[model samples]
Target: MNHYNLSSDLELVSMLKDGDLTAFTEIHRRYYGVLYSHAYKRLPDSEEVKDILQELFICIWNNRETINIGSNLPAYLYTSVRNRILNIFKHQKIESDYITSFLHFAHQNEPLADEPFRIKELVAIVEAEVSLLPPQMRLIFEMSRNSYLSHQEIADKLNISSLTVRKQINNSLKILRVKLGTHFFMLFF
Candidate 1:
């Protein structure tokens, strides 16, 4: 058996600071179980508890040349584990808050349950009003609105002047505005 296993924590810490691997190993062996139990009480996850302890030990080893535990190794280890557990809790809360905010925004932007039905009814009314227009005017309006054609394009297709196509589209709009009230017409057009 290694004699380091019986060394006092202060002696171990001094040896650890002097780059003695055996003292560091003894420190880990003596405190790992207590630290795991302490951290597991707060964190509850075995893997997370293990990782925190592992990282703590790695930090101690890497900074052994300048590590200052002031002769109380267990206090330092316990504090390190406690701080890591608190950080995990803080990160989880942030993620939870972000997810909750995203869900709230998504719910707010979702259409009302009857929105699709209302939209269909409005489209039917608009189509009925558009169909009532004079035949040539209806054709020009449908070309402009449905086919997304420009006035010049409609005029070229129908063998009419661009000015006549524009007038027909304007007249169609006026007729529809009179049939479907200004507020209702504006909703669709």
Candidate 2:
């Protein structure tokens, strides 16, 4: 059995872009646990975390064409998961439920380690999917998501129309809904 290395994400991304599946597996092997745990922290429910990881990876594979990794893949992974989790908090109410799920900690020692990998895979998937959005869509997402701007604020700062801002936000949300599926059912209500 082989373990994974963070130093190799750049190499793996290269191979991944060249249509290599094994490289993805290798990347998955290295980071899935970290990502899964990240998601677990926000999601709390074990079952949903598992599905989220699958969606995350599927999103990555589906959107592998235009991702620019920029050398710090791990940081990118962490930020993406953090954003997604925060998005969950904003859309649904994960903070309280997340606390509730932790009530069974003592019996879950072994499973905890496996959780990170699951979250990280989804981070990878989200990064890939985010990259595939149109240039304006990506810009809107970054300003609102990465920079934590409001719709009105992003519109003013970007000097674009507010309708464009809402459209871009809606576009990103729709894509995420498709990408995340029933795993995010809590988000709608």
Candidate 3:
């Protein structure tokens, strides 16, 4: 182990390529702290930094036969850490952008969940006000608006003059407008 530690990086790489576990352990001991510090500078999370280093070392040991540091193991390790950190940042950005886009789409395209209840409430208020009108006027107003009958049509159905139907409908509208206010009147009628 002391001899492996004293050997140069090139000697360690050669021994590692032959599957020398001691050489691999020496390499890990020498490079882990430097690589961890390099990664932590860019990514402050302790667990994430540890995972990256762990994965990197595992990959090195698994692929030692084909690994090609070529006498610059420190540079290779640093580059690997940098690339991993950049990949993490890219993944986080994509997740952030997706969340932002989803929120925007929901806000623009989705109606409030309570919209039907609100419409029902508004209709109820308008109906309550309309029910307070004179009986004959309420019938005429309902025929003209709800049944989509013209004044002449309503007059023909009710055996009244078109002018009388028009007057009754107008009076009903005036009463509703006063009761419901101009805002609610316009929305319903």
After superposition on all C-alphas, the RMSD of every candidate to the true structure, in Å, is 34.7, 18.8, 37.0
| Residue 122 in model 1: lDDT | 39
Q: To one decimal, what is the Cα RMSD in angstroms of model 2 from the true structure?
A: 18.8
lDDT for residue 111 in candidate 2, whole number 0-100: 58
lDDT of candidate 3 over 74-174, digit per residue (tens):
55666677778878877774455446666899888956479556545533443445444554644543552335556687677667798887676566446
lDDT of 2 by residue, 27-139 (tens): 56445665665577557878767776777677776777776665756665566667666666666643566445556665565453675576666556555554445556456
TM-score result, candidate 1: 0.48
> Residue 109: error of model 3 in Å?
43
Q: Which sequence of candidate numbers ranks them by lDDT, best first? A: 1, 3, 2
**What is the C-alpha local distance difference test score of candidate 2?**
0.60
Worst 10 residues of 2 by lDDT: 1-10
Residue range 45-128, candidate 1, lDDT tens digits: 899889999999999999999877875565566667767877887778445544666689888886547955654553444344
